[model samples]
Target: MLHLITYKYNFIPAGEQALHIVFPEQINISENQLIQELASQLRDSYEDEITDIAPAYRTLTVYFDIRKTNYFKFSNKLKKFLVNYTLEKKNTYGRTFEIPVCYDLEFGIDLADVASFGKLSIPELIEIHSSTRYFIYMMGFLPGFAFMGNVPDQIAMARLEVPRSSIAPGSVAIAGKQAGIYPVASPGGWRILGRTPVTLYTPDNPLPPFQAGDSIKFKQITRADYEAIKELDAHGEYQLKVL
Candidate 1:
């Protein structure tokens, strides 16, 4: 049997060509999943009029071609569609990905600092961080960069006051209640917890295997395993373990 959850939402004009469907301002998984489902439904139902649909934590920004449809007409259509929308509770929502991470000091530069801030030993911090399966609220900032969330309050740390000039790719990090992995080498301020060996992004293939409405669980691994996995991944031999 499935239960139904009621949600209140509003549509706001983003610009002449785009609009936003705004929901409650919170990081709840159920709401985000609904946003994802709505995005998919809109794309399928209004592909001819809509150019793009971007789903975030609490908003779905939809862009439509003015030639085919204006904001007012589209908004009215969306309003009617939403009035009839219903989300059925499910036993499972999205795929769960197990990411292998190495928390050695060399990669996790801010490991000690974050552990200290949490008043925990390194092992305790690692255990707490890796235990939770984080939901991918959205993917932004860069390709393959997933903004996940709700880190355990005990170990949730804030971003660095000053951003780093260069952060290596595959860096697993946390900021406040959010967690993410740096898909590529880029400047970032998120507190570094560790690094993953998987190739998250590449110019040849920009789209990531994962996307919004998915789940990620980090698995702690040794440095040796990291090197071995890195080698296999580089050769396109390693496959990500997913549930």
Candidate 2:
């Protein structure tokens, strides 16, 4: 007999037209997968009534059309479909991305500060960060800004008390348990330790490069490699490796 796993979730009204379907407030992969599956089920069942479905760490916010469907109608519709829904049987280990990050002083202004704060050498800090594979929990703050998780406790630090006015694009930063790249030149408070040459935000591409439930590994590179990749990337010739 095939054993099936069904998870329970909560559907709460976020706004007049938005509903938030949430799993337990934790950072487990199973909870994230359940949230993703819930978003998937909603799209499959209510394709016309739903305008947008956004998944986060443990919650999936569904935006619906008020003119066509309200909370009462939506809940009833979900109950019917969810009873028959089963989790997909496939690999969810997630893709491993070899993102090239340049840790030179020019790109990583806060490298020394972060290293000093962690009571480690710059090389030690980079090695620890590069070796660990990070999980993609959610994408938020800005388009393509992926909120990845579980920065090794040794180097994890709190966000800056005062945020910078503007941070350069491609800056790889970490604060608390989360790490992310600044997809655009935006104001931020995270501790920047390096920068990747890869372009994260692609408006022309329908789907963003990174999605929730993905994984990332940073590969250390020199400044020369960063310049080379940047040039090729500008011409649309560079391709990032995924394993």
Candidate 3:
């Protein structure tokens, strides 16, 4: 149900200019879209005060200028406005991102383990992961980390017992039913199958290259292609070119 209650919050003191609250339920893809939409509304109205809106698995934190924006007042306004915030089941938008995966034995470090767990051949594992389409649920844990969903039923697997020291960027890894890209080089536990050429995170770029509610389609590439892409990246001209 959509919330209509004019939330009266003493949660903020007079001196406080900003506030943050965590919701009880973990937010999935569509729910995040709603939070962003609501924040967009506030942004349109009070461009100066509402500095930014961040969405997570189950919560949204809004940042604003306390000197320019009243914390309690803005909270009450949002509560009342979102009473009709499209609570009904809605559709997730857009075309599928055909991300190319270089699944040569070298890149797919955990391909054998995944095949063993699923009782499938290595070729079978690659076939399954590439054929399926996934929906992005959230973007967090790190910048541009697209928490996409619904790996093939047969391909579902658990994270490694211990996280890796560092996963290569563009690594398409699956932990439980959720899968994600490394975005930037970082430590993770997800069973990495292959690396993509996609540049998921770039600091100099304005706005992240991705957003909530995007689709993903994995395609296979070769070791040579991976090396070529790596070389391009070394020269700082990286771009995901599907083969």
Which candidate leads in lDDT? 1
**Comparing 1 and 3 by lDDT, which wins?**
1
Off by over 4 Å in 1: 1-5
In TM-score terms, which candidate is top?
1
Question: What lDDT score goes with residue 209 in model 2?
Answer: 62
The list of candidate 3 runs beyond 4 A from truth reads 1-27, 87-89, 202-208, 228-243
Better of 2 and 3 by TM-score: 2
Q: Rank by lDDT, highest first.
A: 1, 2, 3
- Whole-model lDDT for model 2 versus the true structure? 0.83
Q: What is the lDDT of residue 89 in candidate 1?
A: 58
| Alpha carbon lDDT of each predicted model | 0.90, 0.83, 0.71
Worst 10 residues of 1 by lDDT: 1-10
User: Compared with the true structure, what per-residue lDDT tens digits does model 3 show for residues 114-167?
Assistant: 999889999999999988877776777887788887777687889989998998
TM-score against truth, every candidate: 0.94, 0.87, 0.77
TM-score of 3: 0.77
Q: Which residue pairs in model 2 clash with each other?
A: none
lDDT of 1 by residue, 27-142 (tens): 88877887888898899999999999999999999999999989889999988888777766543548899999999999889989989998999999999999999999999998
Better of 2 and 3 by lDDT: 2
Give the range where candidate 3 is weakest over 10 consecutive residues by summed lDDT: 4-13
